[model samples]
Target chain A: MGRGMKRWMLWLPLAVFALLFAVVAAGLFRPADRTVRSAMIGKPIPNFTLPGMVPGKPGLATATLTAGRPHLVNVFASWCVPCIAEAPQLMRLKAMGVPIEGIAIRDTREDLLGFLRRNGDPYERIGDDQRSAVQVALGSSGVPESFVVDGAGTIVLQHVGDIRAEDVDDIAAAVRNAK
Target chain B: MAALCIALAAPVLADPSTPPAALAYTQLRDPAQEATAKALMETLRCLVCQGQSIADSDASLAGDMRSLVRERIAKGENPASIRAWLIQRYGDYVTYDPPLSAVTWPLWLAPIVLLAVGALLARQSFRRRPR
Candidate 1:
């Protein structure tokens, strides 16, 4: 082949690789604010009325959980390390008389039960969300998300990631102050 | 050529036995820095996974990227500066965060620019030819 043609052919693969790299990299580094906001702050709570995991009862509707008063809804998974880290904080909230509910997303009943048993059940009501439908509806980015719902069923506050003790207090205060 | 193909595909066929790498190389005590690092990792694409963050990825390279972040922080570099340095060395692809600057204008405006160009090209191409 001619020198110029050979040079062009060599550059073609480099050009293609560069294009692929740029496109993939851009997708990977896309702004995370919209996702983080929806997952952690702004999105409404999931509309699920799943059967309760507690031994005696059938299921607790999402409405039932949020029916009478403002409550704290926590989304946790058996596999999430952050959920394990925040177990004590959940327990503390329960001890302090916060009406905390839970949605166990993408976990089996046995695993959920084991997690609760191992970590200590801090939830008054627990929902089995093995399919993650509830989690998707609630716009959870990952496990260990907490939402404060008002008596009227509006989500007042959402906390992404592990809930620290101070977060619990802030959420509780928000729930109390929610009109 | 046969030997070259085997060499190229060896890593792909090899058993992936490497341990999952941690996100940070050095321990960070500052809550703000930690939060920034966590957010950056989640946004930054793992070169191996392409779709997942270095934080969420189990790839050896992702671990290296995490460790790099930690090492930079340990050297007293701020998160913004560290991110800038990474972008400088690795291009904007290294970060999930795209800097709002001239170099990244095309990234921010690509969709609109492409749409406009397509419309213009279509109009020109479809313009009435002499019958």
Candidate 2:
């Protein structure tokens, strides 16, 4: 190979390496779609009847979810860190008159009460899901998940993680769309 | 794979009933039902762990899912129908093997095409060499 040709060939490898690096870096920096797959997006909530969190109160029923208005079904656990982080967001939504139902997964009432005491209680009703049967029925995967349901009981959207302050908009939009 | 074998063995240990209270709590019995449960669990991804099958995962959520599968099996429900139900609820991610479709075609095709291109480039380079 000619001297000039050899120099040009050397540049080709660097150019290719740079191109590959850019491709990988772009993929790394770009925000990936983190949404969990949910089959219940347009489907009605599954039937479940969970015991009430507090004494002398009615246990939560699937029938209550379809009560002719949009509502939020939030699955949480006192042990889940994100649940505690999202507590403020739940309270904010609660203050704005959103009817939020809670399902406490594998948590004791004492821990739940302590959680509420520390973070403020915003749930209209709480279901003790000690065995996670209700969680399975709802096709839920983890804690601090929120589902936006329409008046007809169809799920519109699912927020799969802790509801940060910015997520309130998405939740609000989901609720509006549910109606 | 080690993962698949381990996943298949988990349902037996996860049974809630019978002697040995130390066994993981689930309401499934019968070898036929357990086999069905194990097979089904092998395909279902543990949503909590995200990297392992429900059978391979020791997460409490995975245990619940195994129990759910066993319950469905006992109710005479077809495993395919149960898989469909979970896919409908959890999306294609719930299954380890996703169906090939418009979006997934590239996932199935890109590697082969890339390999061909690599071979063609290698041949051209070899032909240009003095050796």
Candidate 3:
């Protein structure tokens, strides 16, 4: 009887390992949404003092977020391809008198200007986030994320990924809600 | 067959180049704070790679998080407050050691449950065996 118990006990470690493996594999196969839920969603916008992309242009600061009306704060990078894909939508937003603030994440001034020049600059003020600190503080998942901030500087909504044609309505509505 | 394998693997290897992975081991200014930083890193999940903690991952986001941990430790921020700040920004999913809530109760209980079941099975086998 002792021998039988001992043999079964030997397989216990293997069984546990297999079970753990299965659980881990299941998590891997059908993983949760790639977007890590942002804790900054319901909170106020994080404070930052990023410089302008150019010498004379105004930089983006925390105070600028509370400007009299609600606006969209767009985090972008010259290196991010999605930013290019969403350029036209941003342009459309700009055309509709929507104030678009830009954060150039981890990008050089020359590259940022070049990207803006090529993609049609819709930004009223663009901040150069050389270290990507401000972007991360805003709980942005990656480039092309946009936040709708009300006059009180509260973050109304965060839109992750490139804004598609279908996303314009939701984004505009969020902007309106923030107002 | 060899050509086919090479052709199949080419696209997988060909990805847009980005900045090199930051893996420099910055000397911890304080040895006492080092332990706390290590513990925090182990607890914090890599935001980019959800599968591994910052301690175990070499992803860029993990590297950035490690740097952030060290930076905060250098500035005299305690581990608990730093973790709390990250949790506030990134949510509870940012930590491996989450609260014992309904969402995590099963994960926390699984090992104990497995152990109990294993012991019961072993005992049953023992009782069924004849001398």
Better of 1 and 2 by DockQ: 2
Query: Clashes per prediction?
Result: 3, 3, 0
DockQ scores for all predicted structures: 0.02, 0.27, 0.28
Taking the tens digit of each residue's C-alpha lDDT, what string does model 3 give over A137-164? 8876566789989978998888888899
**Model 1, residue A51: C-alpha shift (Å):** 1.8
Place model 3 in a CAPRI quality band.
acceptable
DockQ of 2: 0.27
Show model 3 residue runs off by greater than 4 Å: A1-31, B1-25, B55-60
Error of 1 at A156 (Å): 1.1
Candidate 1 docking class:
incorrect
Q: What share of the true interface contacts does each candidate keep?
A: 0.00, 0.54, 0.38
- Evaluate residue B77 in candidate 3 and report its C-alpha lDDT on the 0 to 100 scale: 92
Fraction of native contacts in model 3?
0.38
Kindly report which residue pairs in candidate 3 clash with one another.
Answer: none
lDDT by residue for model 1 (A1-179), tens? 47998789789879989999999998889844432423223334456777676575355466764566878889887767788889998888888778788887656567667777899888877887644446545644456788788776777787878988678777767867764
